[model samples]
Target chain A: MSDEGIDEGSRRDGATELLPPHVSADFYLWLWWKSEEENGKFAIDDGRGGVEVYIDDRIALRSTGEERPSAVLTGESPATTPEARAAVAGGKVPRDIRLYVRRDDRDYHVTLRGTRVSIAQAKLPAQVKSGDVAEVLYDRMFLYEELHWIVACLLRAFAAVRVTAAWREDLVPRMARWATLDEARAGG
Target chain B: MGILKGALSVRRYRVIGEVPEGFRDLWIDTLNSHQFREPQSSTHKGEVVGWAQAHNLLDTDFTDLNQWLYDRYAYFALRVDKKAVPAKLLRAHLQKRLEAWCKANNRPKAPAAVREELKETLEMELLQKCLPRVQTWEVLWNVNDGWAVFTNDAELPNERFQKLFLRTFGLRAVPWSPLDELTGTEGLAEAVAAAGTTDLRGRGA
Candidate 1:
């Protein structure tokens, strides 16, 4: 009825009918990696809550309450074995590792290995934005600290590079600032 | 009774019971001397009455009053004992009447072959209407089947859109599952391709 409604209707019709199905899958993976690198960590603390990182199905590190932690983990190349390749091609990962974190009483999971995940592919009930990666990472880190009562500052530092590498190429330069900040904060 | 008498102007009929105000126009005393008797003529009159009754234009007994009217009108002079009817049967009779009317009027009839196509068209329309409200990335992520199970986020509250997505795509909103974590664009591509292939198969089938 309204102009906006008409426009939206047309846009959706075009998107559903014209847009190729495979679009955005590769972009999402690239974006995921780039965002990871930009933040230098998968999770961060903003004087309140920090992030937790999981690598290869293991809890890699967590940030201290004093600072947020960001974590990133890259999966190994796609499984090469016949069986593994079959599973991957069938949308199942036989040998991939997963990352899971609990923060603010909520748990979030990301895959560290194998196939790239998409909201559509993962069958998640809601769409995920690039911004959510940082937020969830922070929350998971916070939960890791509270629940485990262990320091993971070094692991957090190690995972930061993985997070940064996931960002877009243009954002790489700004990531240096993030790295510097991480170092300074770690030293202090 | 008073309204029916006043409305229909029949002298031989008696109102056995009162009909609801909404069903008044639908009720008629079959035994009335003014009743028309030709089967076809009665059927046509019954149709008018049935339409009125369906729309709740008159108030009267909720019993098979519509059918009673149709049968009486269709036969023109049906026995009074045969007049009492059930509601569900009355509804079916009314539907038949409507179908006949459509045929007579040369309106498009819904065929079995076109039913699925019609449903798909309606579903697509609903989805398009819902697109803008669901523009956020979080919402989009939850749009798929397996992904929605892992991410327990709420969907946009467009009932039409929700129904369309659920019915057409087998999508449901649920908490995010661990399996979803391993997915990426490649998986999505594969899924889309699979869906496309299935669509083609369905067409051939």
Candidate 2:
């Protein structure tokens, strides 16, 4: 609730990185690789079946069991958006990441863009049923907690994971062939 | 604004598992098979989940003619309503009933049988006054490309939806975990395997 990740008395389910930290190139790279492997059907961990990642396939053809929608990105699909695809191929990492966390019935939706998260809801309990606003406050609290856990899980898995040096070396040449931009080339 | 708008928050799930050809027809059959059990006034029947548009499930299940076109979406909802006597109010009423029953039966704190009878009487009286609190969760399934955007994130709702989805479609909606959960890196298992004999563990072994 305080920030990303679930706070137990101690060990939480997500990454323990600082808030507002820019997502690293490695995370995207790893995600792309994983997407290629799974064919774009994967969910976010500890998401309790809440948050999921749907990959757009243009480059990686093995990610689906069927020949449907995997080849071409949909109009509004972020998976294979030009910028995102480019970034995954050899473009710079996205400026920021956006995650949408929601409860199925509650009136509010939380938008977490980068370090800032804002909840937008029209039916405030205070406006609808004016007594104690604890339910409303608690709803907000639950929303924040869920988002923090998702962000933490994502950032931690990527940032804190210790991949072998051999993998980095192997990734470089493959990346060099794909990337066009200097930042991507050097970063990869 | 609500579960149905452009500017709303939702956990996006890639619809895993094969949704067979003629999925609409299959879906209608599934919806009818798993229609929700209506809430009753007797017990603490907490919630129920099923088709948002039961009528559609009965017919062609078409929200728009565009469903026959591109970008088709289906609506589903989880409704939670309870009809239970308020515990505190029931307890107080029970106490009064118990006192009156004890006086009528000429016992200090009525025997177990008398207490049970009085409690049942009070329950019948109080059940009539109980009001069910209603909650509904709506979600959209982009049936074409296989995307399920759930509007709520509560554990109960999510769990119910998972069960409901399986019952309705015979498909698994696993909470999609990212790369780590899927492949399980365990500190780059692929890289270490590729490293072969020269790897660190190789020397130790």
Candidate 3:
């Protein structure tokens, strides 16, 4: 609001604010890296505490047990990857968390930080102005929710428990209406 | 930080308890009630108490205090306006006054009582003029999903927002953590729920 003051784009520890992922490593890797299943399914435990899903040996997702907890899926950091780490060590500026999501044939590495998230295409540049976090969030929220939809499906699959069942009953229809998934909120 | 731009530094929360009917009124009333109030020096205490207000982000005039639900989202800009007279500023005034009192009273130094008196007087005279800092926070509410995102990654603003939200909606917001993802599968949801475990996954919930 101050006309002259510098804007602190995203607060410190941007990576810490996301909800952890609750993905299955073996199933996730197979689905993510090898298979072409439209549902690319995994298990979700709507249990107490945060769940860490090792999508692969390299990337993992951590989020709250509650369906809508804040921090969405996060990937292994550039610091953890040998090549990326070496790139940083070699003075190639390492960004924040890089989430690799395979859609169709190509894989997309979505980089995320405190208030930063972007689909990194080596051709086009990553998000530059930190102030653009809001717009970027607007664009990418569905992507996170898309992953969450899978998380919800996984939660439903784990519905042998009482809580997931209740949620199943509450949500109505075993699965989310993915046809207009992003637009689902509009009707509601 | 400066009202979310391209990125949304989200503080995810799970809404506990069903939303009360006519949440629209509750939301409006609460927002109006908490809108920033101007600071004033207390004539009795001779001190200026700090005050905070929320304002509009886009409207530079800051008179836009209305709410709307469009595309299943209630879009609004939250700008928190706060003003405080730092202790050091008050202390500096006290220091100068103390010296003057000592010189006039023919004493080596002013006593605690006299210092307090001078401080009280000085605050009344100068504190009201101190300007406050303004911070803007953009909020997006997915009424369908029952979760909202603020364009900030701050502990204080987030906490304040939670308090205001509960007061407005009569529902609680648990800051989304990695732990929230694993809750409610079966007995675990019960355990956390029964224990009233807030931030069971840690982070000083």
Best-fitting candidate, scored by DockQ: 3
Candidate 3 lDDT over residue span A50-75, tens digit each? 22222222332323242222223333
Candidate 2 ranges beyond 4 A from true positions: A1-188, B40-47, B54-70, B177-205
Model 2's CAPRI class is: incorrect
DockQ of each: 0.02, 0.04, 0.05
Order of the predicted models by TM-score, top scorer first = 3, 2, 1
Estimate, for each residue in A70-95, the C-alpha lDDT of model 2 and write its tens digit: 23222344553445444444323322
Backbone steric clashes in candidate 1, count: 71
TM-score of chain A of 3: 0.24
Question: Cα lDDT of all candidates, in order?
Answer: 0.27, 0.44, 0.41
lDDT of 3 by residue, B1-205 (tens): 3122332345555555686677666656655564444444333232221112222343432223243444445555555655556788888878888888889999998888888888887876764665556566655667767766655556777656665566555666555533334444545433323322111111111
Which scores better on TM-score, 2 or 3?
3
Write one digit per residue (lDDT tens) for candidate 1, span B135-174.
Answer: 1111111111122111112233232223322332233322
